[model samples]
Target: MRGRVDEKLPMDGEACVQAMMNETTMTKLRAGKKKFKRSYRLQKDRETIVYSPTRHSALPECTKRLPAEQAYDVSNILEVFLSTLTSRSSRVDREKAVGPSNCFSISYKDQTPTLDLICTNPETAQTWVRGIQHLIQSRTGETIVNKKERWISEFFHAADKNQNERLDLKEATGLLKRMNVPISSSHIKERFQEVDQNGNGDLDLEEFGQLYRQLTFRQEVEDLFNRVSSPGGTMTMQDLHRFLTQEQKVQADAETCKRIINTYEQIGDVKANDCLSLQGFTLYLESKDGDIYNHAHDQEYQDMTQPLSHYFIASSHNTYLLEDQLRGPSSKEGYIRALQKGSRFLELDCWDGEGGEPVIYHGHTLTSKVLFKEVIEAINDYAFKASPYPVFLSLENHCSVEQQRTMSAHMRRILGSQICTDSDTPDPSVLPSPHSLRGKIIIKNKKLPPDVLEDEVSDEDEAAEIEDPEVQARMQAEKEKRRKELEKKKKKIKLAKELSDLVNVSQAKHFHSFQHSQEKDMACNMSSITENKAMDLVKRQAADFINHTKRQLVKIYPAGGRVDSSNMDPHVFWAAGCQIVAMNYQTPCDQMDLNLGKFRQNGGCGYVLKPEVLRKDYLKIDTSGKIPDKYRKNLTVRVISSFQLPSPSEKSTSSADPYVKVQICGIPADCAEQRTEWKKNSGFHAVWNVAMTFPLALPELAMLRFEVKDHDSMTASDMLGQFALPVDSIQQGYRHVHLLDKRGGDISPASLFVYISLQAP
Candidate 1:
């Protein structure tokens, strides 16, 4: 049977489907240094790509040992790209042997091994690449924006066991279970019968859709709509304007309401009458405009003319390791991921390698290595892809003079004009703004002494080695023994003049007392301190630390003891006006979520203008949770309902009892959390309708995190989905907060319905 494309599918999508359906024979590459010829084709349902060993293959025994057919779900694919773009060292030689143009890879979710394939020719490879890309784009669009209808369609197809375009009672019951809908079979049967308008024993796709809607109808939304609309069950422009102004706190007039009605109203008669039905109102409340994030801050609206020290820069620590610091694989893909995520500041731990080349890896560890030239090449390609702002290369140099020179040569050759050789501004007292340094790559490394004409060995790693006192003590105890055992190991490394000359605006400096830094007042010199030291400074001299950051940039990085690559709360350092709070980009946790959330503003340009209080020295910051009247805001959030939340346990047959924990993360005073009672067996449409209020001391520095968890009586609750965003960017109105999975992928059709209102405290 041939799969049929949807009538609504665009021309490109149709072509992609057509291309995918055609059987193609290609060589599949495996990590065990083995390859097998396979015949691959898209499934009839268009949901999976299945491959089988080609019968004409010479190795019949090897083909027999492999699975008869292997399939990959199209929905699970995260990305598809040319195999040459992969950063795995194991694949590098294989790709070269196979020819880069003839190789492509499909990367899937859940940490699945990437499916690498080599086509017979470059044209065939291009065809597969374009076809898969189009399908992915189509799937992503359906999941993010138009998921509700698409979700129904997917389940409808899933339940059609016989593929007769209809579902029997047994199939309908199974579908409800698969959807995680916990309801009595009697109720399901009643709904199914009602939707079976023709008195048939089975339900068609349209009938099943109606049945699903009836089963998962949202009463909370209907009640809210009834309260907001006019007496006639329809909202006119005046009614919508009133709702927007009063309930949503939006500054909207009649024309705005009319535009919204016209955009969201599905019924032509109601739209022509300049009124909104409940359906239109629901659509408008679930759109981008109704998202919790304020659309005004969606673009680059911040003042970018300020000095670089005046902005909160997104930064990454150890931007080479893909996993743990000890044994993680070092790949240029790490640099690509960080840069794509708007990390303007990146760290490179460069060490001397064989063949007069420099390598990047976690020093004094078992972590794998990648060529420094390859990392630089990746940075050059991806630096300005996400944001057109300046990128700061923080070099942790432990390389010999020759390798350092080679590294500098690679940067100059690959980066070329993008590498900022000198400061553009004449003023040496302040660094240039992000706008002024757009498309520029600034190096942050120790510079050679002015009097030194030749390469000189320096103890640059001494301070870095003793970042954690406990680790330093342990190392010191074993240092003498290790030195005796390995007499040839040296403590110092040579600093190359060429590399030092590349350090233009950002010169790495050792941090001393805040008073000493203030006296020196060099804006071009930046210092990086471990999280422990930064917290100590925040405790002892908060105001002075803020003052020091106003003049010079300070970066706070994870402590060396964090071999697991865990991150500290960045809000502490950010509150002290620290420009760069570097995080472990490889780790995904609440802290990283907060980091991404904070940088999600200002068009995600990797530079967010610091709040006025943090920038201005005169504004006194009370670290004790007390705030001035003007800075305080009363935030009220009413979590109305959640839709189609996934079960936390994949093996469990029971539906999820989901609850939302709303946390305000910022300063000590503003930090607070409130949670709703779990709705038992109601993950499909968990409604809390509970309102919680928080008095935010500093709204600008605050982030609101929404975590949805499945309640379990036997053990700890498992997280279902989570999302975090800046408090100030939250729009005041009825909004839908989309939930993201643990790895930050969109778990679309699963979202929280809420009404947000912020007022003067």
Candidate 2:
């Protein structure tokens, strides 16, 4: 009777076994002990996944959908930690914290949550663990710890044929090639220099590891194109057209489409039935002839013809602290990151430190300190890696005479031949351009004269002032205090001159009358003033300051009251052609955003050429505060559509209803931002027909920032991405405006199709 009953039972268990045999594996599990299993079914040619649930007694079926935007990040879950190793019995309630013996939790980057998941059985737990591991391995190439373990041991053994434990340039290049990173020889040289901090020509295991980690890896061209190719490993003309128009959102005309096909199609010459093979597409993307990077200028174009004062230099203030001015850790990372971002001018507030060495920190504050030699070493290693321009070190000297000498020696030693030590050279009437000072480090500080000492006093002078006894005594005491303070200042000035002697390229001086500045010609009389003082000067002596900046260098730093490290708008001073409009680089505000946009020009070399009018010593324009915008041009932008729009926030599940904002940020009163209406339920593909117009003054110095945002009714819109382009570089007609990430790297496959037009007023 039991055999007959078993034979007549339903075959749902067999159906579940058959479903398990499929490619997809089980993932989600029910909270209770009903033995529920859920697995994801990957949709073909899309990122979407379907959740199928099955019970021990029922057949498998898809119960829910997992959209791409809200999909679980199984790949980021690097490891699974069991409760036994993670939980502490004394600290945590055993019942609530460690729910079950079979329960486990996953850990990922910077996110270690406390949780336990219940598994029905050992087989179920093993299946889940295997599935997660496979997912992680399939997505991320390798964990950093694993890469470190394998890279040094495996790569060093393969490359060090001589068993010297170090590799020269040639060996390093070959090893990189073997790793499938086809880095250029020139790029390899730059990378070698950046890694070889001690100036040694060879890289040991540690240096090689550093280079290996920083080496940017692009997908092998062939592999990349093949992944996107259609059936038979070839893409048709229509396929390429759809990719450009749909995926990239680039509206290339018919002729342009044909040109692209001819450029990339590898099967044969482009014809009516021509198709693109993987090799051809790879060639197009990798070739220097492509429109993408145009690597031809990467190593070739080093513009040094313009004067140093003629370019708007990217500058940073209090560059040692990583956080607020009041309390922050002073590290060399700030200098490294700033220079890597193409900053040419760096400020250092130097004070005496341990063992007679100078240190960098926020003066009179609780911020931690770092050795001045470390900052110089960091600068030397990274100054020209991103931009081949010269670096200007603006020194705020607060050290004693002996410590000042130590600071100078450390700079000379760490920087070596890069420091400009030609103090005895005849002063030129005009300043040298960045072209002439490439790979050089110039110091800028106040050089006080020996005559700044106070006048001598005698008993005869004390008898001259005859008044009431109380008044006379009070005045004498005040006079004595002033004389002592003056004497101390004079002594400090003498010490300041010792450090200032190293400044041959630029000299920091006080701004007096315009005539006083013109009296000196040898030193390129540069002035470093607070933004408040600069604004006051502009209010009282606008014409004189503008005329002076045209010939000499002027750096405007944030006010002393900015304890929070807030930055002032650089455009206010940039309008007067102030060469170095310095700002606190660590702070992220509207001013910093504008600074990024202004320096995005000239290949981001941290030197942008000033407009012709601002470069001239005299202009027939108004001396009043108002800008003459009538003489400027008009800009018009037509927003068409956008594709592959990412979610506003990383935690958002639903797609965003995207919109566009066009802005011209600068000193002109007419500068304002305009936006297009939000596309209704557009999701990842937004389509709109709208135009925005703005009046631009000083087009050569102005910045056009394009912001893409997601519309929300409950809260303010979230910014997706932004791209800042110089007004002069705005390409006319139909073109794609590539979006840039917060760090200012191009975000491929994310773009806006727009028609840009400019008309002279």
Candidate of highest lDDT: 1
Compose the digit string of candidate 2's lDDT tens values, residues 546-590: 677778888887775676778897877876668888777777655
What residue pairs clash in candidate 1, if any at all?
Answer: none
lDDT of model number 1: 0.79
Q: Mind giving the per-residue lDDT tens digits that candidate 1 earns over 1-761?
A: 11122234244645767787889998877754566789998754566787887755464335345567888878778666655423453352312223336677775543455688878876666667777777777764242225566667767875676779889998999888888777789999988888888997899877887787677767877888899888998998988999998888889988888889877887899999999988788778777767788767768989999999999999999989789877678887788778877899998999889888889998766688999988987788679978999999988888777788899899999899888876465676778888898999999887776767555543434224423444445567676654543343234456778888887688877787887777874788788787888898887777788778777899898876788888899888887888899898889988988998888888989999988888876876755446777788899999989988887775455578889999998877888999999988887888888999999888888899999999888898889999999988898878999888876777767889998888886
Q: Relative to the unseen true structure, what is the C-alpha lDDT of residue 76 in candidate 1, on a scale of 0 to 100?
A: 78
| Candidate 1 C-alpha error for residue 163, in Å | 4.5
TM values, all candidates: 0.89, 0.59
Any runs in candidate 2 off by more than 4 Å, and if so which? 1-259, 264-303, 423-425, 448-498, 513-515, 519-523, 539-542, 618-631, 650-652, 667-670
> Which residue pairs clash in candidate 2?
304-435, 308-433
Backbone atom clashes (below 3 Å) for every candidate = 0, 2
